[model samples]
Target: MRVDKYLKNSRLIKRRTMAKKACEQGRVIINEKIAKPGDEVKPGDIIEIKLGTGSTKVEVLSIKDNVAKNQSEELYKHLKGF
Candidate 1:
């Protein structure tokens, strides 16, 4: 999945556009390197997101086109949270 879509589908960010902006601003990293919005993300990849105050790290577990709000958290595992 694309990083931006993954972020939104997983509910990491509130919207796809916001996730894209975050990537453009270098606030999103994949496997420790800065990633573009269209970067491909897969299972076991590590993703870090920089928020206003702090950052969060997550490990991708699975990829799905759509998920319910209650099931979104299952898409990735939270490694660390700020």
Candidate 2:
């Protein structure tokens, strides 16, 4: 799945546009490198997101076709390091 879409479906960013903008602005990283919105995402990939002075990091646990709000957390596993 696309990285931006994965973020929205995973409930990490809440909206696809926000996630896309984040990626375009160089705030989102895949494998420690800046990633575009169209970047492909798969299991085990590490993603880092910069939010203001704070940041979030997560490991792609499983890529889903679609996840409801209740099961969104299953999309990715949170990582301790940002």
Candidate 3:
């Protein structure tokens, strides 16, 4: 799945546009490198999102086209948040 779509589908960023913007601005990193909105993401890949205060790291667990709100957290495993 595309990183932006994965982020939205997983409810990590809440919106695809925000995720894409984040990528464009280099706030999203994949496997330690900056990511583009169209970058491919797969299970087991590490994703790091940098926010104003800190950053969050997660390991992709699964990918899906659509996910329920209650099941969104299953898509990725939180590795660290600080």
Candidate 4:
């Protein structure tokens, strides 16, 4: 799935547009490399999102086109964050 979509579907960023903007500004990283909004994300991939002085890291656990708000956390495993 696209990184932006994954972020939104996973409820990490709350919105696809915000995720895209974050990617454009180089705030998103996957597997230690910078990620573009269209970057592909798969299970086991590491994703890090840096915002201001804090950041969040997660390991992709699954991908889906749509996810329930209550179940979004199942899409990724939190590795580290504020």
Q: Candidate 3, residue 57: CA error in Å?
A: 0.1
Model 3, residue pairs in steric clash: none
lDDT of 4 by residue, 2-81 (tens): 99999999999988999999999999999999999999999999999998899999999999997889999999999999
Error of 3 at 16 (Å): 0.4
Off by over 4 Å in 4: none
Candidate 4 least-lDDT 10 residues: 62-71
Ranking by lDDT: 1, 3, 4, 2
Query: Model 1 shows how many backbone clashes?
Result: 0
What pairs collide in candidate 2? none
Candidate 2 stretches with Cα past 4 Å from truth are none
lDDT of 1 by residue, 1-82 (tens): 8999999999999999999999999999999999999999999999999989999999999999979999999999999986
What's each prediction's clash count?
0, 0, 0, 0
What is the TM-score (0 to 1) of candidate 3? 0.97
Q: What is the C-alpha RMSD of each candidate to the true structure, in Å?
A: 0.6, 1.4, 0.7, 0.6
Q: Order the candidates by TM-score, highest first — what do you get?
A: 1, 4, 3, 2
- Model 1 lDDT at residue 76: 92
Q: Backbone clash tally for model 2?
A: 0
Give lDDT: candidate 3, residue 68. 95
Query: What is the alpha-carbon RMSD of candidate 1 to the true structure?
Result: 0.6
Error of 3 at 62 (Å): 0.4
